[model samples]
Target: MTRPIAKPANVKARTRRRQVSPSLLRAALVLALAASCAFAVPVVLGALRPAQSADGAGLPPVQVALSGLAAGACMSLSPSGSNAGKTVFIDPGHGGMDPGVVGTVGGRQVLEKEVTLGVGTRLAELLRADGYRVVLSRMADSSVTKLSATDSVAGAMTASAVHRDLVTRTLCANSVDASVLVSLHFDAFDDPAVGGTETFYDAARKFAAENKRLAVDLQ
Candidate 1:
């Protein structure tokens, strides 16, 4: 204890050794520069863009072409005379891989997609008999997006899939020049005791009043 212990001869040299190698340092710097350029390029290009459309005269908006349907995939009923020319589009929500809400009744399984399709098809048949041109978004248990040929371009992202499916339904309505669109869906809740029917409309849409009236009538 009286004599102090001597330090190692190489202690200073070991402490001075760099933890990071030269190649590693250079790689980190390169990655940083790449990230910076990636972020900056989009902003610079946007700033340089012209104010007007590329074409001298603004071009018409592109419309998605309707795709052919599988055998008995969709139902279209034409009116006889009274309500002729009036078109109604019916959309049954959820299909294909998206089974939608699931429940059990009387020891049997029930899927929202199946129920919606059944009800929607029956409603379409009734509407047709009442003299209205009716179009079913999907007569079979498949997604509207999958029925469309353009769905291949829709990315694999979940949000993209949802958007494409919804857009496909709207395009179908537009193609038929539908006077009204009836979208059928079944709601689910955490509480098993709760059950009801509800209708909703987008207040910001141009047809807000008409949509509201339709909701009230359904209610």
Candidate 2:
């Protein structure tokens, strides 16, 4: 029963929006969506007609940018080429049960889970090369398990923890000596007209600056 709430101001981006043909106008909008990826919810599109809604269901709606971190924030850190043996959590944002965002890239539809996995793989390789102990929430694609109807970040964390805990016990032994949890997810918005790459962490976390620094470094 969860859905995105529209931000009427977003519609103002287009002044002469009515002048364009329905088809052409749709394509322009899609291009805008494809260009961005982060935020509370993002709707990305590529050069194409109306972004096709996947399986009929779609992403969340656009909100005024919260200059704050989001829960289930996917973090990234360049291997300092130091920190060897430090357990760094490389949390791939969405997984099997959840296909985070559904958007088109170059006129072809792309799933967020796959994209997250691809980037996550590259990140793991980079971390491994740097000699950091990398822990993935799930090595293979799997649906994110839901704990309750709350649909809060805890749901995401619980889903993620399910995967990470297993890895920790089997591999890293449940400790992050200098641990950095990096989660990755694509954006989705209600209008099918928002997009951007953004990173976040618990704003309450004392070291949020550190997380932001790493995210900025990637940008």
Candidate 3:
């Protein structure tokens, strides 16, 4: 066979240089990938996380803020002799299965439960703003009583469901040692013509005078 022509000197020199090993190449690629991931992870996580205030504080949920005003926990508006020491219990009448009244306005349903709850919630907010502690009998359209398995069972256990609900509301007010118990309800009359705000208090209550004054103020 004829002898092969001699390769170019530059090509021979390049061929003689040490080639990069496959293992080293793979290790370099892995290191590059790891570095990219290390830089990207915290950025992705921070974007996905809930936003914090500039001071790194997170806000309380609305429900928690509304329901947090228990006895002795109210933030006082004044340094001394504020309404902070007083707790008020608000009862939104007829929740759950007990819709107190039903009316139609402009072809839309007007539920007393919803109305009472709305009023109670607004009143609670107002009172809390005035530095008073507030507790609601039912925070939403739900029963305040921790009842039995069934309505009948609950009724049997506590005489009647209506009575049980009333008792539960009273107990809640007492438990919180509320300065005042405001039971909110919408009135319905047989004669649609008669409509006005009316407030009543138990005549036998020891603080009947104070109750009357409260009723008058409310009216």
Candidate 4:
């Protein structure tokens, strides 16, 4: 019969020591939940508020009140006035040579790239105000990665260029060890009548279930 060796007193004491503080754990949980809520904010804003219109004018009293509540909810939750160690990655879809889903609004062109960038910028601000480190794929109306000579063919991005551009966004998120990534995009269709919001996640990912949950929450 084999006898089990007893651990040393010092080793046992070390093992009993807590690696993470309860307060930090709670802060992480709160930040995660708040990040999830951030996804729905821009979508609601886009629907209720008109593009290029800044003031609350023309909006109903209830919507204005809801907007205020949303803003308040996005405020810092950390007790120390800083997020324990959480980072959020915001990817604004379609920029540079590819202006996605262009449409005319108020007798002017409204580009999807512009809309996504605007929402992403605002979202970043909110997340930062909430004490999270925010990383944006692109701050301006430009590609996340530098364009190569072959990247643009006749003013349009080639397939390889598009692939590289997308990969760069993923790399950016991974580089920061982002707790969550929110990619802003607007739905477009040839028919002018189609309109609604939808959220998507990758089924092939290891965290597919969690991704689906986030998507559902965002939706």
How much lDDT does each candidate structure score? 0.50, 0.41, 0.48, 0.51
lDDT of 3 by residue, 157-183 (tens): 334766777766665565544567777
TM-score of candidate 2 relative to the true fold: 0.47
Q: Which lDDT value does model 3 have at 114?
A: 87
Q: Please list all clashing residue pairs in model 4, or write none if there are none.
A: none
Each prediction's TM-score versus the true structure? 0.61, 0.47, 0.60, 0.62
lDDT tens digits, residues 21-106, model 2? 22222221221111111121121211211122221112222211112213222222224345454545555555654555555657
Cα RMSD to native, each candidate? 25.4, 16.7, 35.1, 20.5
Residue 59 of model 1, lDDT score: 24
Candidate 1 lands at a TM-score of 0.61
Candidate 4, after superposition: displacement of residue 94 in Å?
Answer: 1.3
Model 3 ranges with Cα > 4 A deviation: 1-83, 152-159
Residue 80 in model 3: lDDT: 16
| Model 3 root mean square deviation, Cα atoms | 35.1
